[model samples]
Target chain A: MDAIRIDNLTKYYGTARKGIRGIEQVSLTVAQGEFCGFIGPNGAGKSTTIRTLLGLIRPTEGSAQVLGLDIGKDREEILARTGYLPSEAMFYPGMRVRDVLKLSADLRKKDCRREAATLCERLQLDVSRKVEELSFGNRKKAAIICALQHEPELLILDEPTSGLDPLMQRAFFEILRERNKAGVTIFLSSHVLSEVQRNCTRAAVIREGRIVACDSVEALSRTSAKRVVIHGRVDLGLLSGVRDLEETQESCSFLYSGGMKELLAVLAEGEVHDLSVSEPDLEEIFLHFYSRKQ
Target chain B: MTLIKHELRQGRISLVVWTGAIAVLLVICLLVFPEMKGEMKAISHLFGAMGSFAAAFGMDRLNFGTLTGFYAIECGNVIGLGGAFFASLIGISALAKEERDGTAEFLLTHPVSRAHVVTEKLAAVMLQVIVMNLIVLVVSLLSICAIGETVPWKELLLMHSACFLLQIELAAVCFGMSAFLRRGGFGIALGLTTVLYFLNLIANMSEKVKFFKYITPFGYCEGVDVIMNGGLDIRSIATGMLFAVLGIVAAYKMYCGKDIR
Candidate 1:
């Protein structure tokens, strides 16, 4: 069974007739144990979609199921089996880090003390400090511990590494990779395109509240335009089917979607010292998608 | 249960401050009652002649010469107003604070359902109200004893029971109001509490608006009514209770369907 199945899900901020659209006709499914990345810019409906699936906000139309349980009706059951890490980490004031972790575990009705201790140690979190006393990164570590300690079947993380330093982010992803290896299905919504590109097997790009593209990482890279850079005097103006062309004295680069043979035929006519053609990174690809939509 | 405990812990410091402040004020009033006992009759007549001012506070009906009478008017308003504010503040902040502090997303995504969250939070508010009243009751009893005055057990107990009920009614109403508020309800709670209080005073002063007594919790639990009648106004108490039940039911209805943004 698919771990998450969202069909024609739409959410509006007000009444459906007179409300701002949050997400429109969003339908996607993630196979069990697949690591799917949800990439979108700010206010692009990434958080809205995640919040709707988690039952924080009701959808204006359509339906969804998590772990085969209805998002609207079986919310408690779905939440029990899923762990969500929200973008912002806010805890009750005057509570110690360990207390917040304990409260989360208790709500789940599980004995997660051992797992919590291990996660805290691995993340280098100090459980003795009060929540209000901790820095932003430390609070995020506490939030990560809370989300991971239950050993859930599915993990949905929204911008999971915003405030963490690079080292801690590495540790956080290491933990996630281990969990994914242990048969956990992960849905990660992130702004850090490279992290998603490096970690996720499949990716879904959202633009203006719609899923503009969804495919395997390799397939997406293969299907989209490739970045071409030449290090010699070349007439980029002669290149057809190319956009975003940048020219310097020694180098010229542009994204090319034309056939490789035609590009080579054109390159042989120029005085070229070096030439490189590469699959564009996710960021560039996403920019392509955004610009194309606009 | 976990939610209730966490909520209680969050409100603990404010609870202590409110309860301690009211208890200290009550103790000070009760301590001076002994020295003022000799001049009570003259003072009672003096207040009786203040026309609407005396009647507004029910000072004209209850004799100020006796300990029960003195305690009723002096300490009654202190605890009445203070307790109402405390209850209103607690109830108003119960649900809204989670959203205001940006904790609702973290909370609602957990295994517990929204209905469960509302129930536990309402339970926490009720529990805090009861605890605060109990502490102040104990302090009042000990202070009366230390002053070597007769406890006037019947009137004192009835008056306190009425005030407790009054606090609960106000709490339920404010709790219902909290579901609709997003942030900074301090002014709203204070305004609601103050309006109801003045409405009771207006009802007491004017024969034309005497029916307004039925609308405010302060009217049914008036100190003079409890002291002179030796019991609560059953009809008015029933009205207040109906309001409380309506408030609680409305709270559950509105909160269960609310989008916790």
Candidate 2:
């Protein structure tokens, strides 16, 4: 069974204008034990989709299910099995980190003391400090502990690494990898493409409230266009699979997708001052998709 | 249950401060009652000349000579205003605090449903108001005894009960209003309570606006009316209860469907 299934889910923030889309007909599915990444720029409906899945905001239309339970009708049951970390970590002020974790366990009706202690130790979190006294990274670590202590079947994280240092982020991803190995499904939303590329097997790129691309990481990388830059004026306008072509007095650049041998032969015909060919990064690929749509 | 415990712990300081303030005011008023007892006639005539002021505050109907009458006129105002403000403050912050503190996403994503959250928060606020009223009750009883005044049990119970009901009604109204606010609602709560009190005052001062008494919770808890009639007005109490129920129902409806942005 799929861990999460959303069909034509849409949300319109009615207060803004007549048709300001929070998300428009967003549909996707994550199979059991799958690690899925949701990538988007700010205000691109990534958080909206996560919030809708958690039943924090009702959908304007369409339907969703989490862990095979209806997102609307079985929200309590779904929430019981799903753990979430919001983009901004907030806790009750004047409470110790331990107290916050304890409160979360109490609300979930679970005895998570052992797991919470283990998580705190692993994350190097100080459980004795008050929530308001903790720095942003520490607070995020505390939030991570709260979300993971209950051993939920599914973990939904939104921008979970925003406040963490590079070392802490590495540790956090390692922990998530271990959890995923233990048969826990993961849905992570982030704007950083490299982060998603490092951790997620499948990714969905959303742009302006729509999914621009959704595919496995390997397939996406294989199909992505390559960046080619040439100097010394080599292009004679005879190259196939060369689109988005640009020319200058001393250099030419374009995205190439055809055979590499033919391209090298074309480049060898000219006096090449410099040449570079590399796989496009996710940002470039994302921009390609966005520009093509326009 | 966890939510309730969290709310109680969070509200402990506010509960202590409001209860202590009201208790101190009640004690001071009870202590001053004795000095004025012998000068009742002159004081009544003095107040009588200021007809509008006397009637607006219910001093015209209550005699300052008798202990119950003095308690009705003095201690009543203290608890009435103090209790209403306390209840309003508590109720207004009950739901809005989640948003103001940026904790709505944390709480709403838990295993509990939105309806459960509303119920638990309302229960906590109501519990706080009850505890505050109970403390005031004990303080009033002890202060009256310290003054060597015989307790008029029935009238005392009636006045306290009326105050209790008034506070609950005010809390319900403010609780409903809090669902619509995204930030702390101190101003709105205080404004609503003050406006209702003044509406009750206008109802008392002018015969033309007498119908305003039915609309304000303050009208149902009139200490002079409770003292003179020896009990609460059943019809007014029923109206107050109806408003309270409607307000709570509306709050639940709005909160359950509200988008936690």
Candidate 3:
């Protein structure tokens, strides 16, 4: 069963100069235990979509369902079972980290302080200091703890890894993967590609309030042909025989639309001592999705 | 901590400052004003001066010079008007500051419901207003006792308690307005409080506009009626209670659907 199902969700934000339209006709479904990333640029409706799913803002049109509960009608029940890590957000400057966690625990009707402590230790977050005393990175970690401590069935995180150092970012994704192994579903939103590529099994790309593409990372890359790089003092134009040729002065690479047979003829004649042919990673596919050709 | 405690803590330093000022001012009014009394004509002339201000603050509900009259004017005029302003401003800020500071995102992502967040914050404002009123009452009574003057206990308690309710009822209105206006909570709270103050003015100015008595909690908790003549008007008390209930209901309903941003 799909853990979340969003159907034609649209949100319109009124403003003086061209209002922001978020997630127009955006629809997708994530199966239970799958880790999915919703990747987009800033103001591309990532946060708005997530907020709508959480029932923070009503959709201008359509609906979403989380764990079989309607997004609009069953918000409290849905929220009760879900963990969320909002992007950079505010905490009472006066609230101690422990107190913030305790307050959340009280509201959720659960005591995950021990688990929160464990997560903090694992994330290298200090639970002793007040929220105000923490740096941005530490604050995000604190928010992460509050979201994950509840043992929720689903985790909805908006730019969850933002403000974290590289080490913390990796640790966060590792934690997310481990949680997914425990049968938790994750819907993560981010603009950064590396984090999503490293953690997500699949992702959907949203552009200008509409989903432009959705697929497994591997399939999305495979759909573009293999890219071969001959990084050297080599003339990039020489590799033009290969399909989807793209070059920058000294080096050249191309998306090999055909099989390896086509690459051998082109490469055999060149001083390609160093050559590499690999399936395009998510980053390249994401570029292709957002590239001008689209 | 709930938003209430968080807010109360934020306002504590200001709370102390404001409350202390109120206490000192009331004590001074009690201590110095009595000795400065002159002839009956002079007293009546003085009452006339106080009455204009009283009428502005809706304190002419009784004769201005008697003990009950004095309590209504001093406590009701100063404490009542001032407390309503404090409570409404504090209440509105408490409700909307989370969003303004970008903290609502932080707080709302937790498993907590919005209802808990709002209710807890409002509870804190209630406690603050109570504390402020208590300071005035404590200072007023101590000053009266130290001066060896008698106070009508029943009327005094009724009037002060009514003052407390007036401030709280305004807080409820501010709290409700916060949910709908979000960023505009402060403006709405201030504007409504001002409008209600005038509505009470209009309600008192004539019998024709007395229908406005239903609109202003200040009118319902008329300081003069409670202070001078006797007990509170039950019908007016019911009206204040009704507005309070309505305010809470509106806050909860509007907030449940409000965007946390």
Give the per-residue lDDT digits (tens) of candidate 3, residues B74-166.
Answer: 656677777777888887777677777787766676556777877787788888998999888988889878766787788778878887888
A223-267, model 1: which lDDT tens digit per residue? Answer: 558899999987756666686788899998988876788889889
* Per-residue lDDT of model 2, residues B183-220, tens digit only: 99999999999999999899989999999888888897
Q: Summarize candidate 3's per-residue lDDT along A1-294 as a digit string, tens digits.
A: 688999998887764225677669999998899899999899888889998888778787888899999987777788888998888856777778888888778777787978998898899977789888899999999888888998899999999877999899888888888999989999999988877877888899988888988898667767645667876544434443255566765577765555465457666656666788888776666665665343
**Whole-model lDDT, model 1:** 0.90
Using lDDT as the measure, name the better of candidate 2 and candidate 3.
2
CA deviation > 4 Å runs, candidate 3? A14-19, A225-278, A292-294, B1-17, B37-41, B46-66, B115-121, B191-217, B220-222, B225-242
Q: Model 2, A59: alpha-carbon shift in Å?
A: 0.6
State each model's CA lDDT, in order.
0.90, 0.89, 0.77
DockQ of each: 0.81, 0.87, 0.45
TM-score of 2: 0.94
Top candidate when judged by DockQ against the true structure: 2
The TM-scores, chain A only, for the candidates as listed are: 0.93, 0.88, 0.85
Counting clashing residue pairs in each candidate, in order, gives 0, 0, 0
DockQ winner between 2 and 3, please give it.
Answer: 2
Report the lDDT tens digits of candidate 2 across residue range A1-294: 999999989999875336579998898998899999998889999999999999888899899999999998999999999999988899998789889999999999999999999989889999999999999999999999888999999999999999999999999999999999999999999988889888999988888888878888766776648888888868556877776678899998887877888898888888799988877776666666656644
